[model samples]
Target: MTKLYTICFLLLIMAFGFLTDAAASESSFVDEIKNTNERFDTRAVPLARQVTEESVLAMEEYQGGSFRVLARKKSIERYRCSRCHTGKPVTAAQGLELTHGNIALAHGTEGPGLTCIDCHHAQERDYLEDKKGRKIDFDHSYQLCGQCHFRQKRDWLGGAHGKRVSNWAGERVVYNCTSCHNPHSPRFAKRFPATYSVPLD
Candidate 1:
């Protein structure tokens, strides 16, 4: 073949190889996200299913944020509350209603209260980020919920809320929003009495 023709052939071969590599790389990246989501689903699905059991009661009709229990009542994979609300997995939101359903918190609180994401930054995108550029997913049950309930959060952290879940020789660890309040309207503690009460002697 002529020298110029041979050069042209080599150039074409190089372009083809580059394109193939790029496509393969993109495919792998998408696959990685899928696998990660699947693993997330495996851990989350059972927890979410438990939220729907008869033991848990519906908190309210409000629907906004990452996961809406009212919407989830229809189907698991079908619910799309995540389109607007970011962070925290979809399943976590689903669990909020049942895992931490509270009867009184929803109606009391003195006025129309806030939604779960109002304080909690599920993806950590709304919250303060780490120096490493990693946005820590705020467990709505604690970190995010603490933003507003400073005194209560402090009390909870110091072995005051319910019982302290702590390690020996370590500071106390408190539960997040999901631990107590359902994400729907009338936010309150799932475990506590809906209305406030004096501690028993």
Candidate 2:
């Protein structure tokens, strides 16, 4: 029985040794294949050269404002409101401050008691918050506005409302609600047309 046990132990040890050797061989084989592929890739593809000032200028010359449409978010000088209001929490009592005192809330005749946080996200100052508390990007702010003003949203989508940028023949890039109408005071301010000179003799 002792002799049998000794033989079984010896067989087990041999099996473990074989497995370890096989694993090591497999790992080495994989590593070799990886190294070979890496070497081939390196040789096949040339390293990209650093873009110089002259190259940049040349590229800029070729690139025109043909396809690119001007986004209103880019025009906003003070976009990130949280930069100043980082520590400050938005409150109703905090009325109109010195920073945004001039903002007239003349959007809806009955749309009173509306605060900044009503549209703007509390956590994300850059994004607008929907009724469902979903973060809407400043670029796609129309989505947030669409929640209440579904008619205008549909009109804008159907190319009825809002001004379309550049050529109307190709890609249609229209201005957002915030572009024409201020988020705080969405009503288009009453502006009188310039008087025309009489051409009668």
Candidate 3:
């Protein structure tokens, strides 16, 4: 009986050794497959890990932790809207094609819907307006967005909604609404996954 037990144990050890070899080969194969996949090519791209306070960024203090968001005032292309938005401000209902050129406003529901004037100050072309009739700075457009998307705002404040800066540590810098969502057309269209696994070649 003891001899039979010893034989069974030896067989079990042999099976484990074989499985170990198979697993090691499978792991290497998976590693090679992953290395061949080139989803995002950031080899030559340069990205800043920590943004300074001087740059177009705003330091935010929340209950969870503190972080920074990109400021819009200076970074905006056609900033100081007073530059060309002079005279009567062009409304979205107007000839947006002629004035803004290809700004398709497709958000909001019927009746008392989202219009340029709803968010943007009627007179101040640069500053945004909240539901409370307060002027929101271009840097803090998140405030204006929060009026409608309270849940998302809450999640963002709690570090759940938006993504943090890429490969970040120490001082956390998170992306705001405008970073991912287009204020004009907030909803995202269907798209392919950023990455996926492929069969070994």
Alpha-carbon RMSD, each predicted model: 25.1, 24.3, 13.1
lDDT of 1: 0.44
Which candidate achieves the best TM-score against the true structure? 3
Candidate 2: pairs in clash: none
Which tens-of-lDDT digit does each residue in 1-201 have in candidate 1?
Answer: 699999999999999999999999999999988778434355443321222321221222212212221121223232333454565455654665654365334522468754444443346433433334334343323443455566865565444664423323222233334445453452443596669988899
Which pairs in model 3 have colliding backbones? none
What shift in Å separates residue 5 of candidate 2 from its native position after superposition? Answer: 99
| TM-scores for all predictions | 0.29, 0.55, 0.62
Stronger candidate by TM-score (1 vs 3): 3
| Per-residue lDDT of model 2, residues 41-130, tens digit only | 555644433222111111011122322223556657777766766767557565446567777765556846677788888877888899
Where model 3 places Cα greater than 4 Å from the true spot, the runs are: 1-48, 52-60, 88-96, 110-112, 192-201
Off by over 4 Å in 1: 1-112, 115-117, 120-141, 165-174, 185-201
| Superposition TM-score, candidate 3 onto the true structure | 0.62
Local accuracy by lDDT, each model: 0.44, 0.67, 0.76
Q: How many residue pairs clash in each candidate?
A: 10, 0, 0
Task: Write one digit per residue (lDDT tens) for candidate 3, span 124-192.
Answer: 887888878898888788888888888998888777898776555556666767878888888899899
What pairs collide in candidate 1?
A: 87-123, 105-186, 106-186, 140-177, 141-176, 141-177, 141-178, 142-176, 142-177, 180-190
What count of clashes does model 2 give? 0
